[model samples]
Target: MVHEGVLVESRTMRASVAEHTEALDRAKTLSLLPDGMHVTTRMVADYFEVGIEAIRSLVKDHRAELSENGYRVLTGAEVESFKDLTSLDKYTGRHLALFTRRTVLNVAMLLRDSIVARHVRTNLLDTEQWARTASTTAPVDNSVIHNLVAWLDARIRETVAHQLGQHDARMTRIAEDSVRTVIGQTVVPLLNHAIRADDERRREISDIRREVAAIDRALRARMPVGGMAAMDAMSWREFEEHVAGLCRRDGCVSVANTSRTSDLSADLVGRTADGRTLVVQCKHFAPYRKVESGEMQKFIGMAKVEYTADIALFVTTATFTPAAVDLAVRHGVTAVHRGLLERWSAGRALQVLR
Candidate 1:
């Protein structure tokens, strides 16, 4: 989904900041207290000079120790989990998911520079540019730096929204260090790999399309004659409803035959909540004939004029030519062959299409 303004929502940013700050405060407080002394949420809150609510949240959110029985505590993998808990939120997860392994690492370094910038009179641009240079060891786009800056800017806005007062110098230092540690280490490295993985995913999709085209050709050459009579007898409206139902069941939203023109008109229009609209041109062609991309393009052109859909879809009881497949991709249309069309029509509305 596309996001407006700063990518991360304000609440998540504040949660990250608060969780980091409290974690640091807890660490320092633990170090100072006697060996066997108990640490309650109240004591931690009092120590940090924050509310009890804040301390309680930090313990749970950061997954840090809560000193049960005043001495015994979680350790080993548990300790590591706490350390990894700082920026565990949806936006951060999405960022990690999208960025490459190297890019994530670079971002973490950039975040460190940004945090330091917050404390000093150092130039923001220069600090980030330096971080990017150090991380990549190559010329980097300043926009990447700017995106990190935007992230920081959003956090600052979040801090304000939470009604959190001005941070004391000690608190600021704790926050800056803690945030840098989490972002630079865990989040950054993971995201870098994610970026590479995403590229790989797109390449895989391209390969699959090629394979599918080959399969389509084989299937088109030998159409199933047994279903022809049943399909021909079914009205277009019945088939449209059947397909629309299947799409809806698959978590897709669709509009069908709103204009109610001839059989050649687009039968179904599908939309995702994210504003991805696809106009479906359904053709119940004779089994042996393969539909050409020229016909698909013709539908796409009409769809743009009639439905103004961002995407065009051709679903037919026939395969499309290789040229049609190429044209579909070039024009951002999707061509679904007869087998897929049959799958889209399973029952009551039109069992014949299946």
Candidate 2:
């Protein structure tokens, strides 16, 4: 009975060895890991040619064993430190889970549902056995041994160079994609916002222009025909006020009479719609009287220097002398005579003597 039991045990052991050998042969045909043995959970999934969720499920089932071996969750400064060490910007954040070689092997051993994981375990076992045998084996011929070593060294260098080139190209593509995404997210919105603001401003300016046109039409409709002739009958102060009123009706904003002060060269000061300072001098004279060149020259000097007026107007109920008209033209002064004053007071557009 003892002899029969020993024979049955030997057969069972042989069968187990045959099964393991077959698994190793099958694993050799599969790509179980990347070029480098170091791996993340995603990397391991890619190595086994399985979905990432499948690897995650495996990890969830055998978390304790994997953690005890080499599974680690990097936190705080460790996350930054690991990214720096790997020279990978994509790895830069807090609370990242990393898997070492031992952790991967442990997970593979514990996985019952994944054929890929079983293949990975077999590959790992074959690799370990090969390493041990290679270490123990002695070289029979020195020349042959040296040749084999040189060939292996060259192959290793070639593989490393190829992997590095691929890695650099992938990183460049990732960087370009990231820049495009940022421009789409940030620059496009900013440009749209600027366009909208500019359009709104233009609409506001158009509305203001329309309103000003309406106000000017109303002022012209309200003006009297013989207003300047009527103004000639008033006092000097009243004439100044009349001129100021005409200026206000003619689109002069902030019009104020300053005729009471002898120190001021202008009877009225105002600003135009286009933000220009307007200086006006009212001359309430008789119809036949002519404004002299000397008065015009003095007023022109004051308007240009003291008040820094963009436009200067000399208004008279009478007309201007030939010399005075010449002087006003030369100094860029507007000499408004009886006809223009009448038209202006009646709310017609002022036609200055150029």
Best by TM-score: 2
The CA lDDT of each predicted structure is 0.46, 0.63
Give me the overall lDDT of model 2: 0.63
Report the C-alpha lDDT of model 1 over 1-354, residue by residue, as the tens digit: 122111123333222222122222112222111111123344444433456565344444433212221223444554343223311122221111112112211122222223321221122222333344345443334467558757965775565445436666676656666666766777667657656665665665567567757855664445432233345545676555655665566555655565376544577777854556756777776655788767877787778887788767676665667677667656666565654454344322212121
Rate residue 288 of model 1 by lDDT.
55
Q: Could you tell me every candidate's TM-score relative to the true structure?
A: 0.31, 0.35
Error of 2 at 105 (Å): 99
Question: In angstroms, how far off is 115's CA in candidate 1?
Answer: 70
For residues 257-352, could you state the per-residue lDDT of candidate 2 as single tens digits? 776665767888989877889999988888668889889988998999989988899988777776787777678787777756665666566543
What's the CA RMSD for each of the models? 29.4, 41.2
